[model samples]
Target: MKWFKKYHLELLLVLPMTFYILGFTLLPLIRTIILGFQNRYTGKFSLSTYQALFARPDFLKSISNTFVIALLSLSIQIVIAFIIALVLKQRFHGRSIIRAIVLMPMGIPTIVSGIIALYVFGTSGYFNELLFKLHLITKPINWLTGNFKGLLIIALADMWKVLPTLVLLLLAGLDSISQDIYEAAELDGANSWQSFRFITLPLLKPTITMAVLLRAVDVFRIFELPQVLVGKSVPFVSTFAYEEYDIGDLNGSGAASTILLLMILVFAILWLKFVDRGGSFGNDS
Candidate 1:
């Protein structure tokens, strides 16, 4: 109470944002939880929705595929985005031009990116066409078929679309870090790799945590890339729920949504535990 009185001005500025987040998040979450437990045809509360959802092999496979793609893509996005951020941090001529190119993918509409990916990875598309003409293969390979290939294509497509936003976030973190620490480490005989490992990573942990949280949440609900790329063959959680909802199976959709929410919850819990155990890694001072 005394702290609130002492910092009342700060509290006043923060209260609006606090309320805004609670209003947008808490209410919808309560509604979804309620809907998830009800029957699509009847309003009765029951677990039949979840039972039926789990009974379908295709739905289970979709869940598995969704996890596999999201995990792999998240890993790849972090690594690549980190490397790109590092490169962009370097002093060079035409750096703005290069940064613009790095950011160009995000400017393209997702549907357009999906369409471009379709052609780029299609059987008769440039990938196979180039390979065939070079005598590297016997025939055109279906790059967008089969779960592994499909996931790879989807991951690549998503990387192009989403990587820029993450890269920019990481870049911001990198920019926030002071250069003196690296110079001091260099003076102490630390090489590039050693300095990066000792200084950059520890200081960047918070930004990485924020990036992972946001990416995990968004990727868990991924729809368009898989929808346009593999259609019903590779159903992500979002696509599956969307299909169920479109068919008037509101409860079923809600059940799938609950599962999606659980996945994000589990990820967030585990990640927070890891962060907590690791202690504060981002204190620059």
Candidate 2:
């Protein structure tokens, strides 16, 4: 009784969050897993839904497409964000304005970003119109057609939408680094490249890992951009799940979602293991 009284205030603070997780996140996940393993028609335990899901060619293609698009988008975003973060770390004229401009995309909704991409890259869009006016081509090229081209456009669009957030995260990580360390490196006659390679990158590994993992999960579950830009033409795992749900195949949708959840877990685990093997988080020393 005395111990309970002592901890009651702390428990009160935690209870709401605990209940919220169980009620919303855990319960929904449990329900999805159960549905994934059950026969839709009979409501009996079965693996037919997963088997059917795997048997579909488009489903397999979507799995590949999801990975490809994620790789492309993350590669572009990380490189650009890192460069921008590095530049922003230094003092310069109009730096605040530039940072604001960099962060502007985060305020735009995903659907709006998709629509903007469509306007810029569609058959009669600005890109094609500009090329035609410049006599670079006699006709407007359809940028959002063909499997690879369409996926590439979607990746670029995703990058534009998410890169600002990544830059912010990297900038926060960079800020946490000490100026004293850079000065020490200079005292050791280490050049800028050497300091960045040895000191900056190693210290920033944990932040980079976190940013990539979060973005990778989102990329694997990509739906809105592809759905808005090309619909069924550019199928992804999220879109596949949505199509199943739309067609009233709740069991199939559950199975696909379960697979996607597992994919995310496995990727996250593998990435953490890789990072752990390379170095400890935040501090290599």
**Could you say which candidate leads in TM-score?**
2
Q: Which pairs, if any, clash in model 1?
A: none
TM-score per model over all chains: 0.86, 0.92
List model 2 lDDT by residue over 1-285, tens digit each.
999999999999999999999999999998998999999999999999999989999999988898899888888889989999999988999999999999999999999999999999999899888998888999778989888989989998999899899999999999999999999999999999999999999988888988998899999888899999988987898999999999999998999899889888988888878755555453557
Per-candidate alpha-carbon RMSD to the true structure: 3.4, 2.3
For model 1, the stretches where C-alpha displacement exceeds 4 angstroms are: 1-28, 133-135, 275-285
Q: What is the C-alpha lDDT of each candidate?
A: 0.88, 0.91
lDDT over C-alpha atoms for residue 99 of model 2: 96
Cα miss at 281, model 2 (Å)? 5.8
Worst 10 contiguous positions by lDDT, candidate 1: 276-285
